[model samples]
Target: VTQRLCNQIAGKLNSRPRKRLGFFTPQEYIHAHL
Candidate 1:
């Protein structure tokens, strides 16, 4: 159970940057915007 929870949390963290940029990776969006 703990391992499953950790995996879910890790996945969320890994995807957070993309979500923050409206589904674009943060670096990709920033470069495009600039």
Candidate 2:
């Protein structure tokens, strides 16, 4: 896959909220920890 496509996929995954984090996006959860 192209680098652009890889980045797009990662962005989408990171932006999705997960039940594991009280419905917070992965990025949001990470930023909170930091």
Candidate 3:
């Protein structure tokens, strides 16, 4: 895939919060816990 496509996917994944992660985005979870 193109770099642009990968970046888009990564952005979406990172922007959306997950219920399993206590409704926090992955980045937020990492920052709070790590």
lDDT of 3 by residue, 1-34 (tens): 9999999999999999999999999999999998
lDDT of 1 by residue, 1-34 (tens): 6999999988777656676688876566878899
Say which prediction, candidate 1 or candidate 2, comes out ahead on TM-score.
Answer: 2
- What TM-scores do the predictions have? 0.46, 0.78, 0.78
Candidates ranked by lDDT: 3, 2, 1
Score candidate 1 by lDDT. Answer: 0.76
Residue pairs in clash, model 2? none
Which residue pairs in candidate 3 collide? Answer: none
Q: After the best TM-score superposition of candidate 2, give how far the Cα of residue 7 lies from its true spot, in angstroms.
A: 0.1
lDDT, model 3, position 20: 97
TM-score of 1: 0.46
Q: 27, model 3: CA deviation in Å?
A: 0.2
Higher lDDT: candidate 1 or 3?
3
Writing each residue's lDDT as its tens digit, candidate 2 over 1-34 gives 9999999999999899999998999888989999
